[model samples]
Target: MNAIQFITQNTQLDSKSVANTVSLLEEDCTVPFIARYRKERTGNLDELQIGAIVKFKEAFVALEKRKATILKAIEEQDALTPELKSKIEQTVDTTVLEDIYLPFKKSRKTKAEKARKNGLEPLAKIIMAQRTTDLEFTAGKYANANVPDEAAALEGARHIIAEWINERTDIRNQIRTQLEKYAQLETKVIGTKKDDEKAQKYQDYYDWNESLSRCPSHRLLAILRAESEGFIRVKISIDDDRALDSIDRKVIKSNNACADQIAMAVEDAYKRLLLPSLSNEILKQAKEKADEAAIAVFTKNLRQLLLAPPLGEKRILAIDPGFRTGCKLVCLDANGNLLHNETIYPHPPQKQLREASKKIASLVDAYKIEAIAIGNGTASRETENLVKNTPFKRDLEVFVVSEAGASIYSASKIARDEFPNYDVTVRGAVSIGRRLADPLAELVKIDAKSIGVGQYQHDVDQTKLKTALDTVVESCVNSVGVNVNTASESLLSYVSGIGPKLAENIVNHRAENGAFTSREAIKKVPRLGGKAFEQAAGFLRIRDAENPLDDSAVHPESYGIVKQMAKDQGIPLTKIVRNTAVLKNIDLKKYQTETIGLPTLQDILEELEKPGLDRREKAKAFTFDQNIRTIDDLRSGQLLPGIVNNITNFGCFVDVGIKESGLIHVSNLSDSYVSDVNSIVSLHQQVIVKVLEVDIKRKRIQLMLHKG
Candidate 1:
């Protein structure tokens, strides 16, 4: 099948839609741009659907490339029979194609090759035919200088037959099918390391055996991790007797001495060749499935975290809480620019709570701080208590921001460039403050993996993980429009077509030529051609621009349609923007053209009604249980308010005002079967969970979602 056909079949999308999407992808159109702007051509396919087409299209291309390589290799050897070439060309499954090419594949010398050189192939064929009942007589005829005795000749013939049995596609497929359906993945602890403290984390996997087909992705990844860590040995197995019998039924032709010889060869092939190769292949497929699953979980968590509620532009006091070292505090303006920085020891050896509180209050009043953001890290609880008790002249909202990747951000090159004169602590405080103001903008600076909302992210394929995470970041950044004038280069880079170089050029241009007052002004940036502008224009918002739609999602190309609507209404553009009555009365059917369909027209109308509207919700203040400061103070069934910090395939981790986050397993998420943990809770979701059990020694807490 062609790429369009393959994508249509695999994704179950309409063939026409798949073809159109492929064309757009081939034309270098970004997924977000095509989904948002070119919906009419794609049959209104969403970003996820477009992403699916991209994935399957790449797979088909890879398959075709592999076929060409295989065909060329076989042709070079003059072994490319018409039937074999036809089979290779017709098959799309990579496994089946590899099986067809296995016999022709060049490799190092083997026993079978040695036997063939010893002139034992004729005897092996005769034995395989099963026509001669006297195998010893037949073997003696083939015995020569290389094969000294009848036994040695028969053994050599058996080796050649063994290679033939291994090369038979049907037998290999039979064993592979068995392994896929019935193989058991077993793990056992290394005796010498059983008592090691680190190994205790994976104790549940030690001496464990489960059906490979039935094992969940999380468990399999854990077992693989344990094996990688030298804590255990993993083995994949199936019933050998059953596999041998299946192969025997397929290969053996008659009930005679030749049949016995064939059976022996079958046994040798399975034990020495097929089982090991097919078993590893099956296991690799399982690991791939697990990697995809883990990456999906991480992608979802990262998306939700990136699009988490933004406490829009607000001047604030951000604190990186600590103990004996003192809490590092920075005062940031509404734009998140650090105006001042200082350290105050509210807790620890100094115990200068009065002085710290006074300093914070003075800074809030001095800097006109609108909100107080405290990092939920070391000494978070104590610092929170101090902030709660501090006297302020005006009511201010206080938020505890997740500091998961703050440390990584502190030492990053982006942070250094942004705050060249500040230390790591100051940069960390700025990140916490900026994260509260706009999550999508600030989180894009740090690597998504360091954000800590993943399951086995480091264990999965890093390249795939990075690609998936970057896709999510791009989707989130574009979905919520960026203010082009104020956005950081890191944030701008994720804006559809504006990559690192273009982002740098845009930043440099803005620095040289003031804020972008109109979308047309952006085209002037060096190295930013028309295509980049086309993909990124709608998603880049310009505040107080000459044209009102410049700040909205309405693409500049569609400005004429919007202007005609305003002209038809006999009203100015400003009156049409955000004017619900005018927007509602505007008939979208009148604006639909050959290129602009109902989908694009409807999007334009919505963008007009709420220009530059953020897709994320507004941030709110949440307080955890004051009495529950530590794990030791928790009791069974004690209700507590928490925020989900991380989510995985198995469960989600909730921060409940302590260092150790509690886990709400999939089983405890609901009484019914919970197929997806995300369906019940999301990253940074405020939830009320009851303590089910607490293992203070292990620093583990089990929680159940409270219905109330």
Candidate 2:
């Protein structure tokens, strides 16, 4: 098959653009680099389309490698005919190629091999021809010392015929298609473990049966996970008689003395060989489709979470709440540097409310804390209540931040290196504050899987998951340009071409020589060369740079054109950079060159109007309803405010200020049909939901979005 043509038809892009993208990918150009810098060459494809092309191109290369292996194996067997070789060379689908190679595959001693050794090949060929008469006489002629009876000879012939039918590409493909369209996935809970406490989680799947094609991705993954954990047995199949008939009709062409023997062989093949392999292939296809859907959801969630609005630099107080251990409190300066940390127990078991209130007020006044960020964990609501009741020197914006990965980050190596003198508690409190300040910068430090925003993250293919998540991070980081002087190594590591080692170098250089005054100064760092600078400079912003455009998205290569625009407009570069009035009057068409199209020039014009502007909105305060602080306090049909905490294929989990977060199934996301949960709700989106069901024993709550 022509891979490039297939890609063009699948991705709906021009063949020239797909070919150019494939060539660039072969040269080791990163997707972000190509999408951002090579728009003129790619027909201006975005990262999503470019990423698809890269994946399919790699698939085509893998297909070719598998074909070579199959061809060599067949040739070594000395049965490779010109016609067979030609067919194998032209086939593209992996399954079809495997089917064509099946008869030649080396295998353990089988019934067919033993039957052939006993001189049953002629009888088997006569039965397959369906033109034979006196089949019993033929079977008797094949009998020898190994096969001494007519019955034994007939049975051996049937085995040989079954093997031949099992390898036919036409018959296998037809059965495979039937299975794909009609198969049902079934699960049976382990009998002895039905009452086991550990197995109780899968009780709902004890006798579950669903059409494999119609099964939702989340439910399928959940069942597979349960099976992998050894609490259930799962299988995919259809009606046994129907499946047998499909192969029987395809293998037996006519009714004759050989017809009955042929029918027996077809049944044996369907039962002993073809059905098992075909069932597995059908389920494998279903699993791959489910993984794609789950990964897409995870990709979208990670994108939204990484780009969540940052509170920006501010003096803040952060709390990681607990009851017996007290709340781990820390004060952070405008840049999120840890200033002070301590523990306070204002909740029960200590109930030192008066003293804790006075201490909190004093810290707020002493540190000039402008906002309060409390982790939404144990005692989080109580802590917020206490903080809101206190009379501070300045009004504070209180935010109940999701602390999903804060503990993981606290114990991480990056946290230890950043705060060698502190404990894990202090690092965790600091993380809570920093993420509230800038989610993108703080989040990149932790593993994306631990963030708790994915559906079946641990169950999905880890390599593919990591690659996709890394792409999301890179896209978000470049989409919102990084601050060179203040960015952490983890953040800078995601900037177009710079990786962890180079990020460390940039941070060390800044510490030794001072802030980067111009984007060009980045080149002075060890090992950061022209190519790296070319790929990374536009995405790395330097605030208050010597050259104003250095802090914007306009690449350094286009600096000359921007300068000419300023010159033609008869205004100083500094004055014209942010002066929308002057930028609006200039003709973007005047700057278009052969290498630069109108797309690039137009992007440059937008950058000129908003130099170094952040794409995310400013973070706002969110509150949960006070009356519903605990699960026991919840009631059916009651309206309560919530924030979407985690999303999956089945539904979204919203935190309503309780230990158990409520689930809004995709069916309940809208009054209209909601195919994608993201279209109606997003990570951290605030809305009101009505309680549908509350199961105290299961610690689960069902919720529906409140329309009004």
Candidate 3:
């Protein structure tokens, strides 16, 4: 049907909201802009709902384009009929459209084409009609030079009938429905790959059989991966007798010899054409389903990790721990500017504990370090102990930060531009420190896939994954307003409308003209037009702006509303913006205009309550049990503290003071049944788990929730 009708049929969203959202999308309004600013027009649709509408509309448009191409092709062949054109135009499903186009599709010479060339059409028609007639007599009527005898004519006729059965839309659709409900996936290991080390990782999938419709996404992806790598052969199968019966019922009419010949043609069509084509189609559909599920999981984990608690602006010392290479250290100021860098060896090769301790103390005193952030990598536990034991001038909060993509960031082009003279080690240390101070700001510089908190990140569709992760990053960045004065180009890139090019322009403008004094100054950046300004102004906060509302989530377009409210209340704008008591009593209905609704006004009131408030929680220092340092140190039934590092459909991976993170399966996430792993545990949640099984040989550990 139409875009609106298609989207409404697929989604449970309000038809009016979907229509408005589709209209705004057609006008090229971004999702964030509509969700945040145009509440009145979209019926207060959130970004997620708006995004879904845009997705569904795009899918429908693509289907329409494909339909147009097919209709034109069939018409060019002089084979298009009025009824067929109506079917193609009215239908939205791609599979149905393809089936209707199959007969007209040009292909190389096949048995059906050859049979028609051999004057066997009359015999094929006899078979198709399934009338009370003698097959030899019907075949004799078509016998010619191409068809030498009655038997030869009968064979060619059967081939033509087989093709006709294959092209019928009703029969194909019936077979597809059966496959969707009953198809099973089976994998058999290649004899030569059984002993290969890489193949061993997928041993569980070898000789596996499961219902394709019921298999978990992770398991399906894993099996598909193994099959792709030549470790196994995956096949989709169903009851052959039932499939033959389905085609038979669709074609066979009379209980005679002609009907028996039609039945044989159905079997031939299934064996030669229909079965292979539909099996591949079903596999592609299953793989796409698995990809979507994996991408959703990846996006959720990335969102939680990006929005993890931040340890607000503070001078800090960060360490990248190592055994043979010494711990690389850097001191950063409150703004995350690198102030000092050094290297100290306190473990293994050097073991100069006193010397390293004195160096750290001196650096802390000299730089006025408020916190210490250590990377949880090789020798992380030992370095943490050393830092905690060392005497300093003030009480310092020590944090063990995940160093998943620190090295990638260190060697990145952004890092090179930011710190041209610093080495990778120094840049890595700085990243660890900055991530603790602000995760969204620091992690934006690194690729989400490289951040290493996903399931099947590499296996999913790359385009879909990138789009999803980019959306998540944008959401988190906009959720927490950026400081226009001090945010780096990388952090500014994720702002609602100011993408990479504009973010760099903003950084250059700031460099040339000094810090932005007001939100208005942003429009002066090169190539940042009015539309970009409208989309990004509210999310960019100026701490000491001339206009008090500029520092909050209130958009510039609504500044007059706030000022009017202040004038009506007989108070200065500055005082009224933060005066909770006055804001509480204000009647928001008085300000409702043609453009502004209750939803937008409610958001403005909330912003006034807590201006420029960070949505993330405050970072707290977490410590693993002192007794546990390595896998060798873990014992069964010992309770220990851990952080959920990565979550998958099956379970979460927790770091419990060892290089090998332990698995807490979905079953053990709590005392109750957990259908969803994320509902129970977040990316960085602190949990108390008891060691269940630790296999030192495999470097694997199993953990369960601590009862106490």
Candidate 4:
């Protein structure tokens, strides 16, 4: 199939639309660009469908190329027959194809290859035939009377047959499939030799065993970790009776004597070769399963971090709370502009409390600050109290922002570009402030894994976690349209068709030319081709532009259609946008096509209904208990308000005015069966819980959601 036909078949897209989208995507056109500017060509396929078509096309091409390469390699070795070539061509999955190719793959010497070179071919073939005709007579035929005896001849024959059975790919695969289905995984702890302290964490996993198919991801991961630390050894074994029965049924069912000999050979081969190979395969599969679970947790955490409620476009006084080095203070304007910055010594020798309070008050008054964002790091609570009690604007709200990954971003090149004249500490404070204003935009600039959202994030597969997190970020960023005039280069780069360098170029162009008055002005940005504009223009909003629709997510390409709709309805564009009545009167059937479906038309109508509306809701102020700041302060049955720090597959972690959050296990999330934690709570949500238990020495706290 051609690229267009293949994409349509795989993605379930219309043939014409898929063809047009592929043509545009291949020309380096961005998803947003194709959806917006290339509507006529692509039948108005949206960004998401276009992206899927591109991914499908790429994967299809790669698979086709790999198939060709494998076929060529097999042909060069003179092993490619018509049937084999047809099978290779028909195979779709890479793994199955590789499996079929395994025996033919040239490699270093193996036991089977060594036996073949030892002049035992005829003897091996007789043994494989499993003839019932007198075993001694058959054996004597291959015996070299001067060089080898009957017993020696039999031993050599058995070795050769064992090698042959092991090398038979079909038999090996059959046994492997049976073993995988019926295997029991066994784990044994390595006995500690008195002085070994390294194995303490894995002591509980010393004798753990479970069925291969039923083991939990976390439990499997824990066992693997134990093995890695030399605290345990894990092995998977299949029932020998069942395995032997399968082999006998396949090769020696009718002849009793033949069955016995074949069974013995099969047992020998499994013990010497297949068992170890299958063990490694099971372990590999387990590791992948564990990695997928870890990635899922990290992905959820990343999504929560990205979607954390924005503080809106308000002037903020951000303080990176510190005691010894003093707190880093920064003032950001409504549009995230760094208005002023300073260091405040509110704790220690510079404990000039009056002076510090006066400095903060002056800055707040000068900048007309609407809120105070304090980094939830060292001495954060003290800083919050200091700001709250100080003589500043009475209406200014103080919020404790999670400062995770702030340090990473401060030292990044993006930070250096955004604040060339400022120090890293100052830049971090600004980031903290901006994060409160627009969490999705600012957090995208930092590595999602470093944002400190999930459990054991550092121990997971870095590449897989990064790919999943990047997808989540991309989805969230695109879901929320960006402002062309106000978005930072970091946020703009995530826009469809824009990368870091291109984003920088766009920013540089803006800097050189001033604020963009319309989306069309982006065409002037260096290296930004027409394809990029087509994908990116619709999502780039220009507030207060000459065209009112530019402020909405309505694409410029749709401007004419909307204008026509308005004119046909005997209403102006502005009137049609504000009054839903006019839109309700227009006939949407006229806009339907292969590219612009009813979905697109409905979305356009909705955008017109609510022009320039902020999709994100305002985050409410949270209340945390003042008395319970650490585990030592927590007491049983004490009721306290806290913030839901994170929600996981297992439970929710609540930061109930304590250094270490307490987990409300899935069982305890509700009186009823709460299968999913997300159904109950989300990240950064305020919740009330009662301290069910606390061990001050162990630094552990147990919380109960029922109290709330």
Identify the candidate with maximal TM-score.
Answer: 1
- What is the per-residue lDDT of model 2 for residues 440-518, given as tens digits with 9 covering 90 to 100? 9999999999998998998888888998899899999999999999999999999988999999999999999999998
lDDT of 2 at 592: 81
lDDT of 2 at 251: 71
Against the unseen true structure, what C-alpha lDDT does each candidate score? 0.93, 0.89, 0.91, 0.77
Q: Which residue runs of candidate 1 sit more than 4 Å off their true CA positions?
A: none
lDDT of 1 by residue, 1-708 (tens): 677778888899999999998999988999999999999999999999999999998899999999999999999998899998888888889888888888887354888888888899999999888899788988898778888989999888999899998998888888988998899999999999999999999999879999999999999999999999999999999999999999999878799999999899999989999988998999999999999999999999999999999999999899999999999999999999899999999897999999999999999999999999999998999999999999999999999999989999999999999989989999999999999999989999999999989989889999999999999999999999899999999999999999999999999999998998899999999999999999999999999988999999999999999999999999988889998988889889998889999999999999998999887899999998999888989999899999999999899999999989999998999989999999999999999999999999999999999988
**Global Cα RMSD, each model:** 1.1, 1.6, 1.5, 3.6
TM-score for each of the candidates:
0.99, 0.97, 0.97, 0.89
Q: Please give, for residues 72-167, the per-residue lDDT of candidate 3 as tens digits.
A: 999998888999899899998888888888988836498988998897877788788888468887778788887888889888888989999889
TM-score of 3: 0.97
Model 2 vs truth, CA RMSD? 1.6
Ranked by lDDT, the better of candidates 2 and 3 is 3
Query: lDDT ranking from best to worst?
Result: 1, 3, 2, 4
Worst 10 residues of 4 by lDDT: 106-115
RMSD of 1: 1.1
| Most accurate candidate by lDDT | 1
Residue 178 in candidate 1, Cα distance off native in Å? 1.4
